[model samples]
Target chain A: MECLSDVGFSGATVGVVAKRAGVSRGAAQHHFRTREDLLTAALLHMSENRLAELRRRAADLPDGAARTGAVVEMLIDAYTGPEFSAALQLWAAAANDPRLRSQVIPLEEHVGREAHRAAVDLLGADETAPGVREAVQATLDLARGLGLASLLTDDEPRRRRVVGQWTRMLEETLR
Target chain B: MECLSDVGFSGATVGVVAKRAGVSRGAAQHHFRTREDLLTAALLHMSENRLAELRRRAADLPDGAARTGAVVEMLIDAYTGPEFSAALQLWAAAANDPRLRSQVIPLEEHVGREAHRAAVDLLGADETAPGVREAVQATLDLARGLGLASLLTDDEPRRRRVVGQWTRMLEETLR
Candidate 1:
């Protein structure tokens, strides 16, 4: 994961990952045959880690108005971390690689659905209500866009303001 | 741009681009000294095309309540096209390449600010009002996130639904 985040997909070769893991190339290959296999396994592991992190953060969220802010912040944090960075590398690679895209698309959908469910639960949103489900999805999308912005620059101050504003908007819409 | 969109940044070599453009390699290099120069030029072209496209669509938008949905659709359209696909390739490449990162970051910021300003103008939104500016920013972010989702799969159905929901929210917020 660190290899993917630090050097990107193309640069994270088997030998490099193996060396970084303090294992011989042959030993690494013994476990995961191809780079695709290794990457798929790593991404699956990262997805689980992200969900676990979301659940852990959900436990500490405060009640009422404060919960919206915390939930938005937590969601934003999920997208801005190294895990997202690694996933982004793989996503870019997969965009042009049909085989990798085939493997990645399902995993991404599963993770996305899980994240959306987690957000809906954390916000105590009733999806049966008109626009509530889309509001939650929009919140997640906004977080991801903020993450994309953060990839190139330190967009923290603007991001904080945006989050604050979205939290307010979400509070009203979800209500 | 098509080359980048179709094959990604690494595969869109000078040779491939030249071949696609029906220009000699010498002529291509004469215009762009390096791959970075070629990509930078292409990106600038793409950005201008996007903004011009936005303005053209903006002129056709309706008045009053219906405008919000049209604006949301316009913004979403801005991000889901070939220009965005080419830009995504560059963004992923720039994330790991410092030199490319420096060039792409400023260009992206400029484009983002332009898009935000355009959205504010189109929505007739008041930035002086509390949360208005952030609302606009979040709208753009949501559009971008929708774009990201479209990259891997045919997310049109869900994207349309989310846009519909967001249009309602924006109409309420801006009102």
Candidate 2:
């Protein structure tokens, strides 16, 4: 996570990752024979780590706008972290590389689907209701845009304001 | 643009790009001088090309949801092309390379600010109003997320559904 996110996928050499993990190169090679093997393992590890965090965040929350706000907050925080950077690197790299694309597509697909399910569960929002599903997606989607903006500029204040505004609108529309 | 987007920033060799363009390596080097020079020039060309399309798409339309849908269509179309691929390349590369970051930051900043302005104008929505600003931002943000999803999956059916639903909500909220 640290290597991939901090330096990007292309920069995440086995040498760098092994050094970061405080392991010998030989040991690292023994565990993961190739770059693809290492990246797949890293991504799976990220998913597991994120799942644990989501479960923790999902614990005990009031329903309605309050719950929705918490879910959005969790999403915003996640996107602002190193994990997002790593996923972005994969997305960009996979755009052209069929080899990487083959590896990343399934990883991303499973993660994206699960995250959507988690968001609905955390918010206790009914996806079957009229317009509710789109509102749910809008919340996550807006968070992504705000997150990308943060990478280039320190627009946290604006991001927070937008999130607040969006949450309110979501409640009014969905409720 | 194809060379960079299809091969990535690191993989975009002068030899490959020149060969792809049916030009001699010597001639390509003479025109671009360096990889940075070539990438920057390519990015500028993409920006100009996109600006023209945005302007054309911003043409006269009925205010309210109709206008909102049109703008979203423009955004979706933009993402379904080479420009988005190139932009993604810059974003991924800029995360680590300070030199590329410096060149891209200003380019992205200008494009983002203008795109937001154009969106608000095209929608004829009052940015100073209660949730109008956030609605505008949300529209663009959501489109971006949908665009990213499209890169990996053939989710056109879901994308269309989301756009239609988002347009209705945005219409009601902005109005």
Candidate 3:
């Protein structure tokens, strides 16, 4: 993440990360078999961290709606927060690199499934409510896109407004 | 895009892009006053290309539903198309780099509005149709998330299937 701050994704290098971590090339290799492995590890580590944090943030909330709201807030925070920029870097790499995709996709799917389940459970949505399901899926989709778009600019007020819009959508859907 | 392909956005330099473009550094500077300017030009160029193709793809559809569905399909194609990955590299750069964000955000918003408006016009959706508007926005949002998620894997069939699911949702929503 530190290295990403200076050079961004296209500029980040394994050598630079290794040097920054104060580990030798061989040591880094032992931990990550390849450059893709190294990046995947770093990304997964961050995802796990953020996921855990999201759960923690939502823990105190009452039910699925509140939990969903909490999760939406978490998404907004994750995107605009300090840890977000590195994710942007990882995404950039994954966009074109097939090798990186192998490592990154499963994690995302896992996260997507988890988030979807949370939304489903929270709304008491049944298998038959395809419309609700679509809405939930769409909410997740828009949040991700908006998150990336938000990073393109540092508009705090806009970010806040977007988050509010997201929250409103969730509420309206559930109601 | 060439620079992104060659260097994957990690180590690409303005000097390198100029060299690859077969232009003198001064000449490159003359066209793009800064690296960000070059990136902005590249993004705009690609967005235009993608939008034009989308317009053509959706033009032949028989009705509003079909047109909307076509737009979703076009979105999937535009996003997963070869140009998209390259654009993503710069997008990632912009997400983390404030200097780059200034250029990236406006372009994103422009393209987003274009897509949304197309969907609205095709659906004949008015502001009062919160459900329809939300549905349109939701589908676009999910397609984005899925597209980004799809980039991390080599499952072409599954990616298409996932996009197909989204297209299906649009059909159902319109119905």
Better-scoring candidate (DockQ), 2 or 3: 2
Error of 1 at A85 (Å): 1.7
Maximum-lDDT candidate: 1
Looking at candidate 3 chain B, the ten consecutive residues that score lowest on lDDT are B122-131
Clashes of each: 0, 0, 7
For residues B1-175, what per-residue lDDT tens digits would candidate 2 score against the true structure? 8888788888888888899999999999999998877887888778777767787767666565577788777766666556677777777788777887888788777777777787777778898778888777777767666767777667778777777777877777788
State the displacement of the C-alpha of residue A156, model 2, in Å, after optimal TM-score superposition.
Answer: 1.2
Can you write out model 1's per-residue Cα lDDT over B1-175, one digit (the tens) per residue? 8998899888999999999999999999999998888988899887778778878878888999999899889889888867777888888888888988888888888888888888998888988987888888988988878888888888898999989988887787888
Quote the TM-score that chain A achieves in each candidate. 0.95, 0.90, 0.80
List DockQ for all candidates: 0.75, 0.63, 0.35
Worst 10 residues of 3 chain A by lDDT: A122-131
Please name the candidate that would achieve the greatest TM-score relative to the true structure: 1
The lDDT values for all models are 0.87, 0.76, 0.65
Decide which is better by TM-score, 1 or 2: 1
Best by DockQ: 1
| Root-mean-square deviation (CA) per prediction | 1.3, 2.2, 4.5
Clashes of 3: 7
Against the true structure, what is model 3's DockQ?
0.35
